[model samples]
Target: MKILDRYLLKTYLITFISVFVILFFIFILQTVWLFISELAGKDLDLMMVIKFLLFASPKLIPMVLPLTVLLSSIMTFGDLAENYEFAAMKSAGVSFQRTLRPLGVFILLLSLCSFFFANNVIPYAEYKFINFRKNIAQVKPALAIAEGQFSDIGSINIKVDKKSGDKGEFLTGVTIHKKSSLGEGAKTVIRSKKGHLISSEDSDLLQLVLMDGYYYEDITPKNYKDREKMPFAKAFFKKYNINIDLSKLNAKEGEDDEITNTHSMLKISDLKYTVDSLTTDYNKEVISVADNLYQRLGVTNYYQVDSINPKKPKTPELTSFLNNKDKFRVLDVASSDALSSKQNLEMNELNFRAKKKDINSHWYSIYEKFIVAYACIFMFFIGAPLGAIIRKGGLGLPIVFAMLIFISFHFLNTFGKKFSQESGITPFLGACLSSIILTPLAIYLTKVAINDNGGVNFDFITEPFRKISNFFLKFNKQQ
Candidate 1:
């Protein structure tokens, strides 16, 4: 909005674009090479490959954005510092922080944009990118499946003799073994006389059409009067479709089931609703289980207490036939009642414990997912401030820095979550640990830059601690 803001923003923007473009292309080249290597033996066309790349680019942007922010901001500020532009601004009665004010706003905006991209756009793009690879693999499985090498496709292990291009199919001499739940005994081995891979129109499928094959299927039977010689034999145009449950395979790759794969783009309200639903459900389960357990525990404890603290005897009685017989009858009556109540209490306790566990599990799931959504804003602060501090505008350095931070965050968050589930850490703490780690770093960087002390070689400072640690160990060992 202000003239100064616009001027500094221009610098940051130019730096941002330059780094993004260069780094993106380099990434593209690497990915393309990987794609080529992956598609080495497959019948993948140029257009299919291009489509794969196109789908993949958006996914790359989210990953690159944080790095781009760091590099660009650093370069822009470093250049301003180097050119005496910052000094000129200071001499002209503008404070260093005042000059940084506009850039701060820019960083804020960039962080918000990154959040949007990470949460909405990138989730979808990443889902698509994963699917794109899957689709490519599906289309040209010649590359995916190798000759003479066993490949696991679903619950089946298949080995093919050879594949040819001119015919655009795989040859016979195929041995297929299928596995199932019946202790690996439910097996199917198809020694096909001949086989070919084919696809139908508009269908994302490939079929292994086998001809004149004797199918050997091992059956698990409760009782067998006489076993059949061969399970099946036919001069068959057997159509085995090459289809993958992409949704099932790529479920974790996206938000949930890839079937629920959404472009909930910029829909904060939607996420809020979903988050609220989970929270409500989680709380409901907690209250419900806790209440149920409390009631069961109360009943059990009350009965047990009543049993232990029996009514005081009217008086100490002298031994007599009537009194002794009456006490025995009383004992029999109390034992019957106590046994029934004890059994009921044990059942209630078991149920309460099981329900309690479910409640905790549900609560944890909600906590972890919510933290993931909030990570957008937290990561922005970490990334933008880091970018400003590092002041290296080219993609190479910034990208590496961004990745290290994010990947570290990602890995820790996941690790913490797993531990949290087992009660090794609190779920809430585990969820927010990444933000906690990054926030202080962001603040420190902003402070450093404000004081005109920007970008340190952290490695130099860190080396002493490491050296001292190593030195002490060696000295102690020698002694």
Candidate 2:
């Protein structure tokens, strides 16, 4: 690289690093602040929040990359223009595209990095982040039991009167109250002299080892006033398995083993496989779904109808309904043609449904991520050229403009994606939205920048207009 090119590249790199760091801090700080109320009384420690923010970093990277480019590009070129480096470079027989070579190289490298981040790293981070939250929630399930606090585990709330970790377990004087949507008003209250928690291997059921307890089983009768309440004198259990299913424990593991596992949070490869599968399934449905309809109605189409000849005026041999024999023959021929056409219409309707499902399916989560990443490329070109045109590199004006432009782009893409999810729009259109909208604008701006007519004049334009307007106003005042 030439010395001038090296200098420009160095400045660009420095600007990128500084801006990215700032953007990361700003984004994460805002997210953490929003959870201030939620985190107020929680047992969340430093390492936990740190872990959360660390896992959250991947989610922020894609969002910040475009902003980083916008800020850094504006700063870098604004510096070049301020120092007259660009003018010197222009005078020295360097073309506009040549000057942009370093920028192009940097953007291409960044795009590859962004793509990898979006595909593998970001997806895995999202997967792990969700798992991390679930695991954290399940932590200290004993400490989760507060004094007089009805702690919920599935449909069961257990409050402990007293706790003792004497035996190196979750020992407690436990009172349990459980309810379910599918249950009667059967209240089972158990008070144990001592109890502890134990988890069965590979199963979600937790074994509550209760010893020396009184059991009260309250059952509501068919009549509310005639309730049945039974109290047991004493209970002694060395060990007992609490037959409770951990519905919360069904939290999705960070694995793409099934399609349900990757409903929304999916990677590129996973989405491709799913979309391909959906397409194939839809095609197969189009072929065999007519059979489902046919089977329901007991209507069999041995062969597809080629055509019905309405033009042929053929008379029927059997004519009994009409007094006129000619009318009976015409009616018979018309009915035969109508029957063939109806069969063909039914087949077309079946095909249309199958085709519609294929066209309007929700793109796998991975596909959505790919769309976001591809949109960044258009954002890159747009940001760079816009910064050059506006010539406002400071955070105040530039940040506002950059954010407005990119946020609109982002929102539109999201809007389209949501519409696609609802089957209101095609996935292909949703995926390529930013590219479709911004590519032409980028090309136009690039052409303007190259020809030195970047939509506005720097010295010769605004100043002259101001002077001419002042002159006309002064003449009007004198008259």
Model 2 lDDT per residue over 1-479, tens place:
88877886888888889989999999998867854533444455788778877876787876788778866776666666656667787899887678788878878877877878787887787777666654553453343445556666666677776655532246567777667365764366676767776653455455567777776655446776555444334455555556555435333334323223454456666767777777777666555654554444333443232222113333435655567777877778778866866887688777666555444544625455665556556666666666666665656445765676778777876777667755676777776676688778778766776777756544554467568889999999999
The CA lDDT at 21 in model 1 is: 91
Question: Which pairs clash in model 1?
Answer: 70-387, 74-391, 206-242
- TM-score winner: 2
In model 2, what is the error at residue 183, expressed in angstroms? 8.3
**lDDT on C-alpha atoms for all candidate structures:** 0.59, 0.64
Report the Cα lDDT for candidate 1.
0.59
Clashing pairs in 2: none
Q: Rate residue 35 of model 1 by lDDT.
A: 54
lDDT by residue for model 1 (1-479), tens: 87888887787778778878987998788777755545455556778767777766765664466556655665566566657676788789886568667766666666666555556665466566766655554555444556787766655667778777654466666767776765654367766756676644345555666665666766545456434543443333354443433223222233353234232222445545654665566556555544554355444333322232433434445446568779888779768767866886687567655444443444444454445445544554555445445544444455566666767876776777666646667767766777688777767776776666644565664467678889999999999
Per-residue error (Å), model 2, residue 38: 8.9
Off by over 4 Å in 1: 1-7, 22-40, 60-62, 126-148, 161-173, 179-188, 196-207, 216-432, 452-459, 462-479
Best by lDDT: 2
